[model samples]
Target: MIIEVFRANGALLAAGDDLARPAGLTSARWQVLGVIDGEPRTVAEAARTMGLRRQSVQQTADSLVADGLAAYRDNPRHRRAKLLAATPAGLRALADVERRHAAWADALAARLSPADIAAATAALQHLATALDQEPSA
Candidate 1:
């Protein structure tokens, strides 16, 4: 299951890259944009939500800022850890990617039985829960 998950992750990342490329964003950048689309959050917060390292998210946020897709705003609660928000352009780009992603997902899901999909989802969740509860090395 773990090996299959690794393979699936790689395939999904490639698909994400393809979906985001036309909009001038990579999978990582689009992911960051999506995270902040709902509401502004600091880099550490976003990283925790995504289960990624803070530094990686920070680099992606910086790139998004440079591309004008996202901007850093003052966090009233935090003095230095500013919140990241998607710009108008970022939202538009994210909408584009989401449309593409939905279509792709629909097509892929069409090939599988709904029952099978649900079982797979539940199994993965169970595995994730067990892993999360495992004692640290």
Candidate 2:
């Protein structure tokens, strides 16, 4: 089960990366922009959302900023930590990626019946919950 899940996730990530290349972003960079699209967040907050280390997210955000894809703003909650937000170009890129993602998801869903899709989604959610309860290494 674990291996199957990992394989699926790896394939999904590879597809996302391939789709993002034309936009001048990688899958990792796209994830950061997508997270900040809903609201501004500190590097730590984004890292936590992505299940990544703060330092890694910080470096990703720094690169995005340098590439003019994202920008940092003053965070009221933390004096030292800055909030990350996507720039106009980033938003445009995100929109394009989101559209492609939706189309891809729809194509996949069309292959399964509604009931089958719902069952698969529920099972995946349960598996994710179970995994989340495990102790971190």
Candidate with maximal lDDT? 1
In candidate 1, stretches whose alpha carbon ends up further than 4 angstroms from where it belongs are: none
Q: Candidate 2 on 23-75: residue-level lDDT in tens?
A: 88889999999989969899999999998999999999999999998999999
For every candidate, C-alpha RMSD to the true structure in Å = 0.8, 1.5
Provide the overall lDDT of each model, using Cα atoms, as 2-decimal numbers. 0.95, 0.90
Index of the highest-TM-score prediction: 1
Cα misplacement distance, residue 113 of candidate 2 (Å):
2.1
Pairs of colliding residues, candidate 2: none
What is candidate 1's CA lDDT for residue 94?
A: 98
